[model samples]
Target: MINPALQPLSDYTFARLARMLDGIAPAAGKRPILLSVGEPQIQPPAFAAEAIAAGSHLWNKYPPPKGDAAFLGAVTDWLTTRYGLPAGMLDTERHVTSISGTREALYQLGFLAVPERKNGRQPVILMPNPLYHSYRGAAMLGRAEPVYMNATPENGFLPALDEVAPEILERTALCFLCTPTNPQGRVASLDYLKRAIELAREYDFMLAVDECYAEIYRGVPPAGGLQAAAALGGSLKNIVVLHSLSKRSSGPGLRSGFMAGDPELVGRYAEYIMFGSASTPLPIQHAATALWKDEAHVESNRAHYAENWRIATQVLGNKKGYHEAEAGFFVCMPADDAEALTKQIWREQAVKIVPVGLMAREDAEGVNPGDPYVRIALVYDAETTEEGLRRIAPYF
Candidate 1:
């Protein structure tokens, strides 16, 4: 029999988009511009490849599931410098582990944290509306109730933890928060993060902070979860911050990232990885260590996204539903009807974008928070991004 949890899920975002446009052909003679997926088109630095090659001989050796000392050392150093955490505050052996990617770790965290029940009721996994699909999938497959905290303009596009009812918080087993949130690009403030961490500790839930887009900001570097944990006290209790080279170093294909936090939770997660997931290959770990150590490539990568966002503002700034994104690499704009707009853009301009409704679920009141918008990834070179934005500007 099919798992009962599978009954609640619809097709994934991209797969649903493909089905929606199955019969429609792109406009004749116009080259298709795909802005639907968040894949970065920039190439990572040459040194990454060199590091991988240098460690090529280790390909036959099974990588340690918890991670090797050298790679974990690099992560610890990077975290300390990037977040200004005090030296030795992070115990690499207990506070960190190599993840194949944040997506994999995020999904596995559901299994690691969620139990069959909380307070004798079905557990709740809280996440923001218009969330990364992985969060929803994790909660659902783990057999917990997925609670969506709608992040709309009324709340500055950041979900307010204080607004959640006390009953809901008590049953929460895991909570996922995304900084520089996907689609909306809003960053959670330091105070907000601290409050969230405090709530998680008080309610005794695991707080999973997705900071994968932490390095793609335009004006100032966004504050991070680890920073908040340090500011509150020296403890990493009840919080784990996830980082990835995907957006930071423009190396999604490398599939390298790590999660760091509470010693007990992290240790369990590391052990869980030993049985539940594949270890990151030694060569990839070597490349990732190099990528994490160097800020030059990340700076350059941010420049490309900055340029692309600038072009978006210059082209679509005056449009009715357009606003400058605070961070992250998407232009999520409002539309009268997102699905229709998506199809029209493909048919008329040969451009592809995602209807925001497809990425989010309806609330208890039956209103889908993403119904009024569409998400376009500005994850391309400035010129191509401009072309795509210009083509879809009229719809907004």
Candidate 2:
């Protein structure tokens, strides 16, 4: 029998989307363009394949839960340079461990941080309303109350810290913050991140930052949780920042990334994975190390996304609700009715876009902040992206 705790996670975003468009076929003679999911269409660099091939001889041996020293060192070195942390601020063995992807680590954080009770009450996990689905599922499965903080245009698409009740903060076990947030594409500033860290410390909860999209931005590099900690006197406590090569190197298939911060938390997570999670293969780890060392491919990937944004603006600039995404590949725009519009675009134009309502939780008044918007992923090649935008523009 299934566990009762899983009841709250019945409808995943993509599954719900598929059900919504089930029997309806796309418009006649037009190719279906799927912008519903944020999978990058670009090919990963050739070096990834070469690295994997070179390390393939070790496939017979079981992979290690905590990756090899080379992989760990590569990740730590990259983090130090990326966040501008002090040279010796992070110890390879003490501060970092590799995960298959940030998604796995993000979900595991709930189990890693939640307790039987906090401050004599059920523990709470706070996340933005239009959050990554894994965050909510993680909280429910871990038996923690998932608190939805509404993030809307009024709040610059970031959750407002002041709105959280004092009581919720008191029992909070973990807080999930996504920078270059999914669907919204809003990046959290250094000061904003510092404040969240401060709250987590004050309330004695874990702050898990999902920064998978850290490498895909339009302007200045987004500030990270580790960077904020360095600014706050260089201590890694009550905090864990996750990074992934999925977005950075356009290698989601690689499924390689790491969680770094709070030596205690990282250590516990490594222990948990040792017993419960699958180890990342040795070959994959080798490929990931090569990826972390190279920035040229990443720069090229960013340029492609930048051009996609330019194309979006040129095509839909006059639309009333269109706003250029600050970072990440998705464009979240207001709609008369997100679900209905999503269906209309699918049926009439053969273009698939995600309804933000599917991702957001309802507010106290039962109003979903994302009910009026649709999120479209601009992850295709320039020609494909331009065509998709052209098809979607008419509906707006």
What tens digits encode model 1's per-residue C-alpha lDDT throughout 73-171?
999999999889988889999899888889988988788889889999999999999888889888876788999999899998899889999999999
Task: For residues 1-396, write the lDDT of model 2, one tens digit per residue.
Answer: 988777756677887888888988889989999988889999999999999999999899777777889999999999999999998999999899889888888888878889989999999999998988889987976799889999888999899986899999999999999997888889999999999999999999999999999999977999999999999999999999998888899989889999999999989987887789986899999999999999999999999999999999999889998888778999888898888888888889999999999998897789898899999999999999999999999888
Would you estimate the TM-scores of all the predictions?
A: 0.98, 0.98
lDDT, model 2, position 271: 89
Model 1 whole-model lDDT (C-alpha atoms): 0.90
Worst 10 residues of 1 by lDDT: 3-12
Task: Give model 2's TM-score versus the native structure.
Answer: 0.98
Candidate 1 lDDT score at position 52? 95
